[model samples]
Structures are given as structure tokens and as C-alpha cells.
Target: MAVRQVIFAALGVSVLALGACSGDGDPILMHAGAQNRGPDEFAILPTKPLELPDDLAALPAPNPGGANRVDPQPRADVARALGGNPAAAVSPGAMDGGIVNYASRFGRNADIRAQLAAEDLAHRQRNRGRLLERVFAVNVYHSAYEHMWLDKYSELERWRRAGARTPSAPPRELLDN
Candidate 1:
């Protein structure tokens, strides 16, 4: 009778343990003493397709020309009156009823040319800044790596002098392993 009771108690405890381990349908499992082969061996299944929001479906396509495509005639007139174009015979820096003839020698609007020049200058300035930043970053990284290599070599020499087992070759960690 006592043996029967012990068996029943053990069975009850095992049943509770199994119940506690019930999962929410995740399929992967790992066991002790198993080597992790890498991401390819233990990857999760692909997820369901994502649904785009309803409001995004109604959004209009963007205009390819952007905002700068609008006519700047009024601004061009102001530029022309400023003596930007000699052929127009408009006095320099003079505002003729807010309609300046900003025409250039090439017959192009001076205001448009000025706007393009400003944009070009800004683009070149940004590129220069980016180039300088990259150069500085590369120099810093090179210097840091040089210092680290020197420090590692010095430590290796110290170990050798202390009669420690000097490897026939440098340590694997020291190589690009």
C-alpha cells in the first residue's frame, strides 16, 4: 500500500512538471551538451506578411519636379532692375517697381543663376565636410590600431623575459583569427 502511494505521488509531480512546460507554439528546442552550429542551424521560421495601413493606400504620388519648378518671374524682375544684366540697361542695385530684370548675358534669368550657384556652393561644402570627416576617422582608427599592436608586442616580450612559455609563433588571438 505504501509503495502504491509513493508511485502515485511521483506520477502526480511529473504530471505537474510537464504541465508547467506547456509552450505557446514556439517550435525551437535546445539541449545540454549540444554545440551551437550557428544561425543557419537554429533560425526561426519566416513571419507572416505585413499589412500596410489603409491611409497609406490613399496617399498621392509625389511630383517629380519638386517645389523649385514654380515660376519665379517676380523675383527675376527684381534681379533685372538691380543691374544684373547690362543689356537691359536697368540701373544696378535699383528696384524698379519691384520688377528687376535679372537677365544674364546668356539670356538666362539672373535670379535662377544665383539660386543654382547657391545650391552648388552648398553641395560642394557638404561634400568637403564629409570628406574631411572620413579622413579624420580613418587616421584615428589607424593610430589606435598601431598603439594596440605595440602594446600587445610589449606584453608578449615581458612574458618571454619572465620565462613563460613563449609560443613558436604569436598567439592565435594576435593573428586575425
Candidate 2:
């Protein structure tokens, strides 16, 4: 009886040792869902080969038929309205009289020009103040009022000083466009 029990214990110990050793040497069986079924399901499709042209440098020049075409009649009408002759309007270096040429005409001591600039500045300030008031009125928050106030007065003062240093002049080449 004792010998049979010893043999049974030895057999059980050897079986457990063999299972541990087998587990250590065996590769893990990965459950990759449907990917591990077979190569027939996961095989890549063959790509079609591309054929190149024999003469690569024989391309034809671009056609200009689709380019925009301009009509001279409307341009001539516009030039006529701007004080140029409609028939002889196609000449180069023609004076259309569309430009005022203030820099050439008005000296630095021109009272009318200075008065016009001051009036324009006053108009701009009134419009800007009204706009700022409307914007702040839309929002009931007091912080918006403070921000608008600073923007209108302080920023406008800075811009006015900058403008005084470099007084605004009309753009050159007014008739070209």
C-alpha cells in the first residue's frame, strides 16, 4: 500500500513539472480574431504596373484661346467720363485731369487745406464716439464701458498725435486705377 501511494505522488509531481517546462518552451497562441485564419484571407492584391511615355520632351505649347479678352469700348467710355477724349484716349502719357495734385498745388501754409483736415478729424472723432457708445450700450457690463472709453479717448489721442507728426495726404497716381 505505501509503495503504491509513493508511486502515485511521484507521477503527479512529474506531470506538474512537465506542464511548467512545456509552458516555458511553447509559443503563445495569439487570438488575432479573423486575421490568423489563413493566408488566403489576408493576401495583398497585386498592383498594376504603370507604363511611361516613349517621348517625354515632345509636349506641345500651351494654347492661349482660353485667356481673358478685354474690350476697349468700355475703357474708352470711362476715360471720356474722366475728362479725356473718347476718340484719342488710347495715347500714352495723356492727362485725364482726374488727379487733384494737392502736393504740387498747395503749399505748407495753405489755410483751406489745413481747415479741411481739421474738419475731417472732427467728423471722424464724432463718428467713432457714436460707434463706441453704441457698442458699449449693447452690453450692460460696466467693464465694457471702461474699455470703450479708454479705446475712444486714450487711443484716439495717441493716434491724433501720430497723425499730427505725419499729416495725412491724398494718394498719388489717383487716375491710374
Candidate 3:
């Protein structure tokens, strides 16, 4: 009975050890909810439209560690906790009861990613990589953003735009062409 109990404990310990080695050795993503990007809340300093009173003596007594009244209300609860009426403090245009202005961008970029992807595909097609560029891959992207100094394609494009004119058609381009 003692031997059996000892064997069971040894088996359990070995199983737990094997479980630890099962990982792929990659860093475990802690903040998967944020797509591993972590929090961006502290990225930019939050500002409010509110201004302080000019009269230094008329100002309210400052607490030991009170939040600034001039600070933007990040949320309705925060505004309420700071002793400010959210309904009155928030502007008429402010949605979500005077929280962050992030709500104003709601539905604004619904199809923007898809549209940008399509545009990217078109841009890549228009500027297809050569054999050397295909090997490197970086040069293709580098040329995409660079200025048209000594452009080889512009000359080719100029030929495509130059059509067979019927009886002296001197091109007056830009909308009239």
C-alpha cells in the first residue's frame, strides 16, 4: 500500500513536469484582450476645454491629492467621483455621458480597413515588382513612397496617354482632354 501511494505521487510529479515543457518557448501573451498591444490610455495627455478662474483667491481650497477640475473627464463615473455633474460638465455634442470623445468616431471607420486593403492591392498591382525587386521585396515598398525623380514609368504612362489624333488634336489636358 505504501509502495502504491509513492508510485502515484511520483507519476503526478512527472506529469506536472511534462506539462511545463509543453509550451513552444515563445513569450506568453499576457494582455491578449488588447491584441498584445497593451494599454494605450497613457499614450497622450488628456486635456479639457475647461479653464481656471483668473482670481487666485477665489479658487476652491486644494485637497491633499485631489484631481484637477481642468482635467478632461475620461468617464462618467470618474467625473461623478470628482464631484462634477457629468450632464452639465459634458457638452451638448458629448455622447456616452461626457466620457472620452472616442465614441464620436463610432461607425466612421466601418469599411475603412477593407477600402484601404483594396487600395493597397491596387497600388501593389500598379507598381508590380521586377525580378530583382521580387527577391529583395523591400525595394518594391521603398519605391512606392519615394518621389517621381527620374521616373521610368512616367515615360511609359505618357505613351499610353498619347493616342492616335484625328486631324491635329493638340491635347489640352486636365479635364478638357
Candidate 4:
């Protein structure tokens, strides 16, 4: 009886330990590990209502590859709903010219997003876990970036010691006497 009770207790503790290690850590870093539970709410969008024209013959000839009359135009619809010019929203270059020009003044790489995504994927792959960790599907994101971690409070104190103004920084924690 005593031997059986000890065995059961050890088994219970081992099960709990295994359960603790099986969790998906830091969802932002484990996007690839995310399971699809249901349909994405944002992907389901309502189409524009169908409208009958008073003069049917006045409509342009239907082009097989052209935009449909009832197709959802989210940007234009949003602009129109807000009493703004829908035409301006539909044509990108026509509106916000000054802002766009200022932002791209230093020159712009059209494939910047794609380039960055490739670079990030390469970085993550390079910093991936060891054979055992990979086999077990354990996340190593935090450990991989451990060396790059900054000590913000120490940095604030260092700047203060150097006579740099740190007006925005909160007062340092009070040390007990």
C-alpha cells in the first residue's frame, strides 16, 4: 500500500512538470505555432449593394477582367461615408502628395517590405534552437535575443551620472537604508 501511494504521487508530479513545459511561450514570437481555431473575422467583408441604373444602355460594355459593379471598395466606401472625396482615395498619388513626397525625399525602395521580411526570416532561422530543442518544438526567441537586452534603469542612472538631462525619466527606486 505504501509503495503504491509513493508511485502515484511521483506520477502526478511528473505529469504536472511535463504539462508546464508544453506551453506555447510569447505568442508574438510563436506566430507560426498558432493554431487556426476558426475563420478570420477581418477577412469576411461585406460587398457593396447592387444598384440598377435608370438607363441600362448607357452603361459601358462589360469587360471580363474589369472590376464588378457590386465589388467591395473599402477605401472609397470609407471616404464617401466620412463625407470625404472618394475619387481622391481611389487614386493614391492624387491625395497626400506633400506627405508622401516628404517621406520619400531620401528615396524609397519599393521592395523594402519584402526585403525586410526575407532578412527577418533569415535572422530567425540562423538563431534557431539546437537539435533537441528543434525536435521538441521549444521556442528560443527570448534566449536568442538575450544578449541584445537593455537594462533601462541602469541606462537612466548612467545618463544621470554623465550630467545629461533626463527630465522625462521617472525618479530612481528608493534604496532602503
Candidate that would win on lDDT:
4
How many angstroms is residue 95 displaced in model 4 relative to the true structure, after the best TM-score fit?
Answer: 2.9
Q: Which has the higher lDDT value, candidate number 3 or candidate number 4?
A: 4
Query: Against the hidden reference, what TM-scores do the models get?
Result: 0.17, 0.18, 0.25, 0.49
Model 3 lDDT on a 0 to 1 scale = 0.61
lDDT per residue for candidate 3 within 1-177, as digits (tens), equals 999999999999898667655544224342121235555787776676677679978988878777777665566556788897775665446545445356655645668799999997898778867865554332355466455446644544565578634333333463244
**Pairs with steric clashes in candidate 3:** none
lDDT of 2 by residue, 12-59 (tens): 989866755442221222211123333564455443355465887975
Candidate 2 accuracy as lDDT: 0.51
Q: In model 4, how large is the Cα lDDT of residue 149?
A: 81
- lDDT (CA) per prediction: 0.55, 0.51, 0.61, 0.79
Give, for candidate 2, the lowest lDDT window spanning 10 residues.
Answer: 24-33
Candidate number that wins on TM-score, 2 or 3: 3
- Model 4 spans with C-alpha error above 4 angstroms: 1-35, 51-59, 83-90, 139-177
Residue ranges of candidate 2 with Cα displaced over 4 Å: 1-87, 90-93, 97-103, 106-123, 126-132, 136-177
Q: Could you give candidate 4's per-residue lDDT for residues 98-135 as a string of tens digits?
A: 88999999999999999999987897799898986776
Provide backbone clash counts, one per model.
9, 0, 0, 0
What tens-digit string does per-residue lDDT give for candidate 1 at 1-177? 999999999999898667655533323322122345456644454433555657976866787776332333344455577857534544436655344444443465548888988986675454443454454322232332343355766677778778899767587477544
